[model samples]
Target: MNTTTEDTDDRARRSIGARRNPASQEAILDAAEAVLEESGIGGFSIEAVARRARAGKPTIYRWWPNRTLLMLDVYRRFKNARGFPDTGSVRGDLIALLQNHLLGFWKDSLCGTVYRAIIVEAQNDPDAAKALYAYQEERKKATEVIIERAKARGEVAKDVDGRLIIDMVVSFAWHQLLINRLDEAMGSIEGVVDGVLMGCAGYKR
Candidate 1:
């Protein structure tokens, strides 16, 4: 009778553990981000993340095979938090977008650290570089759609290259975020819009 009760209790415990494992996976990812921020990518390891998450290394390896992929998960979490904004007008929209990006980079230490690590990893890892490129392309598509809407409304010039302008806008913002502090970065929506219009517009107001 004692042995049977012990087996039943063990089974119950395993069942509860199984139920909570998914949530644990999320916790592990969160902990991984913290570790990455505290130690940087150079120091990140599966064992370290497990220690931070308070789970075994097997639990982490079950979900993410490597630290790079795990960091990607952290990046995805940050990206999801800052949903894309659609402010109606191109000028307003561009400004809002840049402001949100700068704010995220400056305010969110985990995100800032992850972004820096990804930039470094992309230099050597082709897979990491491809993932970053894909993320950028998706963002470009969103901006391109807005630019098309503006062109249709006669708000922007028809001859302007949407892709080129998008590249310019992103390049400038990235430069500001990477080189200077967000506060010091010259990322005014009005300024970007004005500069773009000066080059692209046929008529001046």
Candidate 2:
């Protein structure tokens, strides 16, 4: 007796629906990252991930629904695990964040690839763009805390817009990733932070 692909897929989906544990979720995410790393976004798909994880397309869909969502999860999982920085001063914190993104994971790990894929996906898929926007908002809110902390310490202007500062910083990082110049961007992180802070200084009260 041999099991058909349909039979295997049904079993996989049923198993997941019956008992979706953390380990299974982690395995799917792990497979997603591996697929993105190996095939880039062009080759990334539910089928690819399912095959890699020994899962079914229905199971992956039940978990992520779309490639963009799955890719975002893959990107977010590692980011949460890496956490954020708090080096006392806003400059130090900003620089640390930039370094962690540009020189650390974005350059040296799978995060760069995963995020790059997300950006590309956003260009073509409206849902992906929306998902990317929502994801960025969440990240921006997290980064805004750094500015709020600076405000408390009199490091930033009371009237300064933290979102604008985040935009500048994020835009710079995005450009570097797009151009494949993350390494060179490292030398400019401090300069970028200084420019943002200096521009925001006039708002100090």
Best by TM-score: 2
Model 1 residue 108 CA deviation (Å) reads 5.5
Residue-wise C-alpha lDDT for candidate 2, range 1-205, written one tens digit per residue: 2766676566555555433556578778889889988988779889999999877788788877698889898888889887888889999988988998545569988788778888998999988899999999999998888899999999877998999988889999999999999989888888888988775556767
Q: Which stretches of candidate 2 lie over 4 Å from their true place?
A: 1-14, 18-23, 37-43, 200-205
| Candidate 1 segments exceeding 4 Å error | 1-25, 37-43, 54-65, 102-104, 157-160, 186-189, 200-205
TM-scores of the candidates are 0.69, 0.82
**lDDT by residue (tens digit), candidate 1, 1-205:** 3446566556444432222344555677778878887888777899998888777777677676667768877887777677766788877766766667644454445566567677777788887788778877887886687678778888888987898877887777776657746565533656776777565467666
Candidate 1: deviation at residue 157, Å?
A: 4.1
- What local distance difference test score does each model get? 0.70, 0.84
**Model 1 per-residue lDDT at 195:** 78
Error of 1 at 29 (Å): 2.5
